[model samples]
Target: MSFDEMDVESIWMDGEFVEWDEAQIHVLTHGLHYGTGVFEGIRCYDTAKGPAIFRWDEHIERLYDSAKPYDMEIPYDKEELTEATLELIRREGLESCYIRPIAYYGYGMLGLNPSDCDEEVAIAAWPWGAYLGEDALENGVDVAISSWRKYASSQIPTNAKTTGTYINSVLASLEAESNGYVEAIVLNKEGNVAEGPGENLFIVRDGELYTPGLAESILDGITRQSVIEIAEDLGYTVHDDATISRGELYTADELFFTGTAAEVTPIRSVDDNQIGSGTKGPITDQIQTKFFEIVEEQPEEYEHWFMPVEQ
Candidate 1:
């Protein structure tokens, strides 16, 4: 569909809504040249109350956090951005959508350094569904252990979702897709299972949940954290530890990936070995069901995380 004709799509450029084709940046933009931008991928769910931004506050907090290491200062305040996001969703009359807020180094004198540019912000929204394969939720996905290794904290902070960092994910994802795998599992510099290219990794063993710890160059995924809390509430003990070997993956009774776009997806196999009888395991399915329920209504503890848009 044409940009304007596409229902429930809005592009917020600079400080206002613009035609999708009109949202352009100069070639000299520092972020374009040097990958010096930081952005957040957020989801808005249609609920009984109209539309609710899932974990809106947490996503904005991470957007700001992602900017700090690059010394980039965002121009807008939290409440302002939040309001803009809500308005954009409402204007589009969207039921469910994907929202993006980006802070980047704008047009500037060209070269390696970025000091000559100003930081610019843009927000956009579009109707979005599952980010992965159609059967990814039910049949689960097959993943290859990528030859590409994840970046070390000493080289670049993995904690921040910087544009520069995603090159690693891009290459790994390309490699995985080319090889007929749905995603790639990148290992840390030390050969530990770091995470899926775009999501955090979780495995279930004997009915308990296990995921890579924060120190292992993970993104500290909001969905991962939410799943942990939900798992505990459901009486499942969770483990956060370094997943050092492929042996753990092959032996695990269940596996999954978690992120903003990923939501909760079970991993049916790794490389060629089947994960627990080659089907979505019971605990993984349980957590996935609970997650869907939780996002549909704000649990008392997570109430502050959501922002409601009027119908």
Candidate 2:
């Protein structure tokens, strides 16, 4: 059967497995209205051993953590959602797919307050190859420094993965595309580089690695943390501090972005200035290669991050 013909089941409204086509939510749902929800992006990789969920525990933990700032309680516990996500992927027989878990305030009487609405959880899986398409990493992406600044912690918790906060990212991304750029780097209110619209930013300079510090008003991404750990383990010196000025990014030896969806993608240019001869640098390529190997190779040390699913 073709991929489209394959039966896919999803966990709907309160954890009911229904045909994917039948999964529905009201238009007036609180989350839809005021964006009162939080979500996660997880990847399941098809390996020689079987299909394994990558960083399964980390993703689930972040899902709950993201909800805390919004005061949105996930109706299910960690293990509950964990097992359900695995089951959803298996039901679809997806060897390699992306899993999305969302917890949001369901339909309720119209008002801005979300505490009155019941929380709804849903899990959906689909075949996802690359988030930004194939050529994004191969040739490196052209990035623009967005006019939209990252939301300050005073406005909303900068750490949580809230749907509401993504409006800024959405706007930045759309603007970048319309301006002939593949992605955007959003700065903080103080005009310091924070991160990519949905990814963490890293720069290499003088044989040292640098990324915006935690207080830089960027989401502390799981993939960003993993990349840093992997780099340190490989004997690289990392400097986490403020990254300001376009001059810094333009003159860096290499520039790259890290996140669940973006993975480790190299940036070829920032606006019109060429970064390191306008090509994917050596360090960026090394980290990307190592990341792929670990995600697919099942190294003993990283085995705990994978949840095996086999028929």
Candidate 3:
């Protein structure tokens, strides 16, 4: 849904809470011009206990780490950002929502270098449903191999969630959607499967799980890591470092994409070629089921993954 359609009211900017409409930045902002910013997408689930953020600590750590490559330093510490996010949700009375924490260079000189610009940070939360669509989680989404290839880490820090690098994803997504596919599977420079436009890809074969490794020019997605652990704990052999080829996607028994937004969505087809039964496979269902269960129920076994909003 669009922000205008939501009932959100406040946004945490820098160290203060500002009215949602008041949260604005100049067009001359360095990050806006040069994409010299880092951001994180996180989820807060409405669990049995109440609203709780999933894996918030890890997300915060990654947000900071993403800034390292650009020499940008976030002004707020982890605790401060955490508190700001929690308070923002509480103020908005959001039981379940998607959180976006962004740090970027503020308005200053227009040169390619941002040495003189100040760093600006903001956190916003709003209700969001399944990214691909609610039906996508059940029936699976159809995808196509993008004509566009994912850029190599050598050219850019593929692991970092840089704002500018997403033009590659924009192109791939546009290509797939224009061709009538729900999503796109991007390939690396080597013609190996990298990941989805905004998610990590996992292929299941012979009841085992496989995903592209960090070296495959994919982001180290938090949900990707969580799913890896969840699949392993369920007695499935996972090849985390496996390099997947385009041909392998069509031949896989099942396929899925994982990320903060996509969560665990099954990919039913690639290039219109049906995978397995052309629907959510058994293994994919099991992992997706467990993932929702953990987020909604907040079971003690995985309690460490949740950070209660009330606390």
Candidate 4:
């Protein structure tokens, strides 16, 4: 839903809470012109305990890490940003919402060098449902291999979540939608399966899980790490560093995408070729079920995964 349709009223910006409609940035901002900003996408879930942020610490760490390569320093500390987010959610009275924290170079002299630009930060939260659609969570989605290849780390730091680097994803997403598919699978420079537009890819074969390693030009997704742990705890072997070819996707026993938004959505088909039974396979179901259970129930065994908003 758009911000106009939500009940949100305020956004935390540059150390203060401002009216959402008033949270504006100048057109001359360096980040806007050069894409020199870093950001994070986080989720606050209504769990059995209360409203909580899932893997908030990891997200915050990534936000800082993303800024490092650009030589940008966020003006606020981790505690500052964390408190600001919690207060924003509490003030907005949000039960479950998607949280976006962005730090970018503010208005400055227009040039390639951003040394003179001031750093600006803002946090906003809004309600969002299943990213791949609700039905996709159960029935799965159809995807295609994008003609656009994922940029290699040599060209850009693939590990960093820089705002400017997302043009690659935008192109891939546009191609997928225009091609009458639900999503796209991007390959790395070596023509091996890298990942989805925004999510990490996982393949299940012979009761073992295989995902491209970080070297495969994919983000080290927080959700991907969580799923690996959960699957291992359930007695499943996960090959976190496996190199998968494009052909393997069509022959896999099952496949899925993991991300803060997509969660554990299954991939039922690739380029119209049925994956296994062309449905959410049994292993995918087990892992997806456990993922939702942990988020909704906030079981004590996995308590470290959540940060209560009330705190």
In model 3, which runs have C-alpha deviations exceeding 4 angstroms? none
Instruction: Give me the displacement of residue 29 in model 3, in angstroms.
Output: 0.4
Model 2 stretches with alpha carbons more than 4 Å out: 1-9
lDDT of each: 0.86, 0.85, 0.95, 0.95
Model 1 per-residue lDDT tens digits across residues 101-146: 9999899777766778889999988876787865898779999999
Error of 4 at 229 (Å): 0.2
Using all chains and alpha carbons, the TM-scores for the candidates as numbered come to 0.95, 0.95, 0.99, 0.99
Candidate 1, number of clashes? 0
lDDT string for model 4 (108-209, tens) is 778889989999999999999999999999899999999999999998989999999899999999999999999999999999999998999999999999
Off by over 4 Å in 1: 1-5, 299-302
Check candidate 2 and list the clashing pairs.
none
Name the regions of candidate 4 deviating beyond 4 angstroms: none
lDDT of 1: 0.86
Q: Positional deviation of 256 in candidate 1, in angstroms?
A: 0.5
lDDT of 2 by residue, 1-311 (tens): 34466556555447778877678889989999888889888888887678998888888888888898778889999878877877787777789887888999998766898888999999888877777767877768999999999888778988888888899999999999999999999989888899998899999988778999888898888888888888887789888665666669878889999988888899999987889978789988888888888888878877777889763
lDDT score for candidate 2 against the true structure: 0.85
Q: What tens-digit string does per-residue lDDT give for candidate 3 at 1-311?
A: 78789899999998999999999999999999889999999999999989999999999999999999999989999999999999999999999999999999999898888989999999999999999999999999999999999999999999899999999999999999999999999999999999999999999999999999999999999999999999999999999999998999999999999999999999999998999999999999999999999999999999999999998
Estimate candidate 3's alpha-carbon lDDT, on a 0 to 1 scale: 0.95
